[model samples]
Target: MNITRFFIQGNEACARGAIKAGCKFFAGYPITPSTEVAEDAAIILPKEGGTFIQMEDEISALGAVIGAAWAGVKGMTATSGPGFSLMQEHIGYAAMTETPLVIVDVQRGSPSTAQPTMASQSDMMQARWGSHGDYEIIALVPSSVQECFDFTVEAFNLAEKYRVPVIVLSDEIIGHMREKINIPDKVEIIARKMPEEGPETFLPYKAEPDGVSPMPPFGAGYKIHVTGLTHDERGYPDASNPETHTKLVKRLCNKILNHRGELTRVKELYTEDADIIVVSYGAPSRSAITAVKNAREKGIKAGHIKLEIVWPFPEEIIRSAAQQASDIIVAEMNLGQMVYEVERVVKSDAEVSLLPKIGGQIHRPEEFLEMIYKCQK
Candidate 1:
């Protein structure tokens, strides 16, 4: 076993993970809290036979990654809230064109340039619906430095599998925090499936039974017509036809949504008989688990749910937890974002509550205990 271990920051781990996942092209602009990801990529990618370019802005950074993917290389980019905001339009373009790319957003306090060095999970909603139009997105939230690496690699695998962009949602705390992690010499990698047919017979946008089309890299002798407009199976614009647009859009969304069972990844602690459930992801999950253990000691029957994959919004898990627990508490470093999704899924089956902490602070286990006590009363 050729496993190497190191003590590193979450952002560094993300860059290393991208390399391990066969990401050969990286395009990014430096931004606080996430600059290290790009810095690390620039240093390591070239050594690993990958190319790294710093773009003028986040929009161009993502645009470059999208272009790289079409050229048949696994690609990635990283940013903070402001840069992530700049990348939204390009994100929509990647979704529209079904480009396989990975984006790492190390979140900070926001609406605007509120706090750069601070930590916040306020961007959770933005990740899901930041861009205009409807398309399913795959997003993962890492709670620790280790997951920052693991999730980045998984992000690449999922992106290639579904032919869509994948987001790794990390907060400033998780991004800057240092921890020891083991990097395996060989991790499972999923390559892009290519068309078996020759260029003359290949239809770029035509999907198989799995709802994914085999992609041929540029210069693979396949005359590919890539477009952001309503595209047909031939990958050409079919703008005016309502049926073409509906069918094309639905398949794009369903490629990920319909495979929700495979996309959902979560961790359950003491949830089997829990009366109070703490639903959280990213940095907050660190405190949530501690609070849950403390509650259990006091005979509170408390449990914690750590979301590894956030988007496509794991409704089934929350729905089952709602059925088992009387009160579900969602703790996040936001005013109130993901809590709405919990409420929607839980409905009247259980009471949904939010424990929001903003202004660059994470919840302490004691704060969670107080919330649990209040839930009891």
Candidate 2:
């Protein structure tokens, strides 16, 4: 499909992507770095016969999204660091209940509200394991405004396709940056599969061969008992039998892990024959790519590994890169979120070092060059 070029801010592009993905419900509170997303939804959703609610808090915002998703509508919410922290519990709920929803986290700095208006990629690990519990989350990190638009739509599609909460993890830099994005006239969108059996035979948690249960909307004839606790195929709370618990947990994890081949996506730059690899994601990755190219000019064998899908870790690719590369430098906004994952996969085989920074500042290209020099030495 041909896409038309248009200059747009990352947040605005995300909203447009969600609208294109058939999102009909948005409930979120206003937060810096992410407020533009809510604002755009407020203005555009109504025009598309969609509903937008300015919730009182991030908790309520996520709650409303879950409710709307259960009602058979594509639902989403956008927030920054503090708000993202508040919504973790509900994120867990959405995972346990197999609820399909999209969360736009325009991340800012810190363990708290460190920087409201500034950017930070510190939320990379948080997006993966912020919520309490063992569950799989699909997170997409877009580097440019165009990907911000394209990935938001893809986020919604993955959410509905997997019946799990998907997060569009952006940072303040990308969220507010204005760039030209080619918005497609007509793009492919995926919707959830409704129950096929009669109400009497329907089991909300009953797994298919692929382990994904057919979703039934709230008002649908097939009544669903959604809860955060471990449940049986019938959707009723079932904590007694270890067999049931094992099956339920396995299904939840396998539904995503088994499909890793499809879920894991990434971008590689000049990886072939590169002795040193700079691993990064989100906006920081943009700088890493430049660093790799600049290092190459100076006779350094440096390449870049840019993560598009953060969750599931892309272990296969990381492992391959680790085995082939002499050194791996992880550059991220946080002190060591994704660095740990790289270490785990790469280990002593690859000399792994973290070029860490926080508090609204990103890792500079010069820092990456330093790492490349160290790797060469």
Candidate 3:
């Protein structure tokens, strides 16, 4: 078997992963930390028989991606905090329409672009509830360059499978970092399920028991109605009907939430007999995991839970860890976003504390160790 290896930036790996996952359309606006994802997509996509377009802004970039998805091609876009904020409306649009596309947000210090070239995980909550209406979306966080590739592939697969927008929640640190990663020649590719019936008999939003409808491409002779308003199974706008709105919205959220067991992905170490657990995601996990390892070396019963899939937030994992551990330390590059979810889930089962690092820096290993020691005390 021929093996390929390359030492590349996380952004470049993400582009390559999208290409591998059958992403044939990329529409994006350049922003710091995430610009290289579009840069590499521009360089690699054409060679792979794909199209790359730089839209006027983040809104149109995602608009183009949503357009491409309806046209039967896998689509993707990448951006940072401000751009991500711009794409929120379209994110909701994609959810209401059940359009399958991948969005990569290489987060930076924010509010209003506080730090462009620095790292942050402050976008965690935004990724979950950024849009106006209620909907569920899948988000994957990659700690290493290898996961940058792997999770991008997974993001596309999940998007196509669930017929929802999937976000790659990368930060500046992982987006710009360089490392060697193995490129497997063949990766499992999952395409959207097409309708079995003819176009005349199709109901575009009619779903199976799993709450996911079969998506038919635009040119596939299917006359489909796609809209952002409350839509029925026929995809027609029924904005005034309360029942239609409730059913549509619930399915939009539950299509992902109901499959929580399948969507939640985390990496655990030393959790079996741990007294303290450090929970983290994105770039902060890199430090949190190391600290847990060092704590173990010092005879501390510390464990680590690295969140690979950030949303539909992994409640069960934290709850189980809380049951086994006396204290849980939540490490993140923000002022306590996901820690709140951890606290909510753990809720008196275990003492939950936040170990936050903001303003463009990540938590150091020693900081996590100190927190673990403090928790122990």
Candidate 4:
């Protein structure tokens, strides 16, 4: 596969990536930092014989995507801050119904539309635990325009591969940043595994050997019922038996956890033989990496754990890095979301501190450098 380089914005690349990933339907509202995604999709999807719908609201946008996915088309939606909140219910619905859809959240300042145009990584925790239920979510945070494109495709692949929603957790800075991105001419792509047998013999929720049930489209003659409530193997609402509830829940989580090796994706920089480790993700990781290099030049034993996949926590990687470091500092735009996860992974063995700053501004390299120096002392 030959990679081709071109200057492109992150949001534009995301739309192109989805098209390449076989996305045939796009339903979304216009929102800052993410509007480019919808704009591009509107122009490109139709040209590619795909459908693009400008829904009235974010809720409807997500609902349309879910509806399209059940119709056996690769579907997606893009939004930021408040819109992300509006789509939570549908996201939960996707979780329960096991619909394969990709959600692109080009995150902005939050709580209630704090900043529309400014960038923020505040949604890291929200993306993971926003939906009101117990289900595993796969989220990828891209640091650059290239990763923005690459991870968007991966998000769709993971969604279809696992029969769950996969979120591309991007922020305003990365979403809007124009950079030279090398998109491959021939890239590896994965599609949903459809059922081989007839619809009469199909069980929509029947667990496969990989824990992911074969997906049957809505119009595929498979009379499967999809609901938010706990369901049986045949997709009927089954809340009567506790065992049925437990099994379904286990399958939902196990589909991802049991295949963690295939789902977990991360990138590390200079973690070996480091006394201080800085954990960061998304656009903030760019500054964190710069801080690490500058700290090393000043003879500080600094390294970084840049997260590519935010959800599922990456406990083993965090624990292993924490064990090797004397201190771990979590730098994020939110006050203290990922810091809590760092503390849980490191326990009491290492000093874990929160270097959080919110309200649309990113952490500067000097800010992280100061934290490293203070931790060393």
Candidate 5:
């Protein structure tokens, strides 16, 4: 097994990672800051004996992905805000159907074509609340190109394991920037678990003791009925029954929320004796890391939390950081989106401050350090 090194953009890296994770079907509609993901998949997937399709629109793109997932292949799609907005119905549908899939949202400026080519972390909140439901989501924010590849594979693994749609929430910079990444010859690939029960007596929606139902592939003769309607253990529509709706929805949420401890990941620096702890995700975390070091160099006890898992919010990590800091500074390329969650979790434990950047620009290390020092004061 030989390792291959490649200098490539983040979107391309993500496309390659999806293929590495055993994704056989990719359906996407091209959009700014995310089109390269579709482009690269178009080139790479067919060679791997997989299928790549450019759909009519974002809605159709995700519809195709959902179909492919049921057909027993790991499926994925990429888009920015506009396309992502269009995919919300299917996102909710995938959640309700318990379909294992991955979506790469390389976010640009939002609120309807705000900045097509610029970077922003404004979509951080949307990643959590985009779909109109109470289902839990797994969203990984990669600060660099290497993580773009790494977390794309991780997303697929999580999606298959939980049987939910996992999202890779990248920004414009990370998606477009070119960086060197080591491609492992044998990265771990996890396939969706199939039921051991025979087709003679199988109920597709029947979750195990672990609260996760195995997804048998279509044409596997399981006689399964998949739908967005409220379903029971038999996978048949049961929308009329309130108890069935409650049970199905609760299981859908509890399955991921119960596993939140393992699904969450964070990077920490100088957090033990910190007076100011900067919290960030996506590209802003890069500057947050640098600012923490710069503050430490200046004899300031500043720590940093690079939150890789943005959804399910990584509350425990923030609680840990808050235990050691006087000031919790939340920084992002937005006008305070994730700062609300940081404020909620670390309330009264640490003084929460916001270092917001808007209009598609990034905050420099020195700029964040300046804000950190001010908050320290």
Candidate 6:
């Protein structure tokens, strides 16, 4: 119940935040721009009487987190692009099993082993669809060291509340940046719900009106039969049955999609009566905000939206902003990955376009201002 100030890097902030959020377990393999998360966890978790393990690889890293969560501990893992690529199948499995876990991806540039120490928002799309399945994930973007702390806590909260993996989508810039984080007195921490009934009455995947089933961790003993195969309410593999598979998959997608109104959030500035809108997130958002302010001083009706919730995207908000603008300029540290997403939701006379800056750095504020000026033209 006391406020504190700490100047630290985003990765350290994320580690501290995970601890504050009551994360009791961390499983990870060291990767550039994100290894500090595991490093910090190693120091802090043991003090909290928690568990920290360095797995053989990124796949086992996530696997350990999943197994720990099933054992009833709040669990997390961190990695960069290459490591993230290895965790995809397990990400889908967490979604399928409705496991509560937090994953932090400090994005680097490109396909394989590209720019390990550099920054890129190239993984924004991957955060949502990296796994080879049709399921939704909650992805959060942190623009500053403070948000790195706050959003890591938020990721765990969302994961436990919704029974799904929540991704903390960071870039090397945000992960490595050192800044002051105002540690709050005490923040909210949410834990997963456990079954309230006897073992005989327990149903692992029962269809609830809310579409979330309470979980009973291992040794709590409600007939734990967790698996990757499509299962029914009873937690038995029913993959051979077409109906069971369809029901399970649809339920996984709907739980997040149906409640997106409550799940999605964004940061908006000067967007109400603007003629042009610059949509940006993560590190690029810092420049976008400054450029928007400078654009206003020059008498241009320019606004910006800093996307905080990337997946289960703030479609409603984007659609509304696009309708009120003359053009929408999407900016990011990648070659137009998120621009396509913006295009899908916008229905304005405002044409949507992308301002990409790849190869390790972020878009300069002046660079964004130039695109803003051109988009309105």
Cα shift from native, residue 208, model 5 (Å): 1.0
Minimal lDDT window, size 10, model 3: 1-10
- Give the Å error, residue 149, model 1: 0.7
For candidate 3, give the lDDT of residue 56: 100
Candidate 2 Cα deviation (angstroms), residue 183: 0.3
lDDT to native, each model: 0.94, 0.90, 0.93, 0.89, 0.90, 0.91
TM-scores of all predicted structures: 0.99, 0.98, 0.99, 0.97, 0.98, 0.98
How many backbone collisions does model 6 have?
Answer: 0
Candidate 6, residues 235-302: lDDT per residue as tens digits? 99988999999999999999999998988789999998999999999999998899999999999999
- Model 5 Cα lDDT, one tens digit per residue, 1-377: 88999999999999999999999999999899899999999999999999999889999999999999988899999999899899998999999998889999999997899999999887777778888987887899999999999999999999989898999999899999999999998789887888888998878888887789788888988868888999888888889999999999999999988888997898888887788888888898887887788888889988888899888889888987887788898988988899999988998998898999988888898899789768866
C-alpha displacement of 164 in model 6, angstroms?
0.4
Greater-lDDT candidate between 1 and 6: 1
User: Which is the leading candidate under lDDT?
Assistant: 1
Report residue 219 deviation for candidate 2 (angstroms): 2.2
- Candidate 2 — which residues are off by over 4 angstroms? none
How would you encode candidate 1's per-residue C-alpha lDDT over 100-174 as one tens digit per residue? 999999999887999999999988888999999998889999999999999999999999999889999998999
Quality of model 5 by C-alpha lDDT: 0.90
Worst 10 residues of 1 by lDDT: 217-226
lDDT of 3 at 214: 93
Task: Provide the clashing-pair count of each candidate structure.
Answer: 0, 0, 0, 0, 0, 0
The residue-by-residue lDDT of candidate 3 on 182-281, one tens digit each, is: 9998788998889999988889888889999899988888978888888888988999999999998998889888999998899999999999999999
Residue 353 local lDDT, model 6: 85
Q: Which ten residues in a row have the lowest lDDT in candidate 6?
A: 341-350
Question: What C-alpha lDDT, on a 0 to 100 scale, does residue 104 get in candidate 3?
Answer: 91
The whole-model C-alpha lDDT of candidate 2 against the native structure comes to 0.90
User: What value of lDDT does candidate 3 attain over all alpha carbons?
Assistant: 0.93
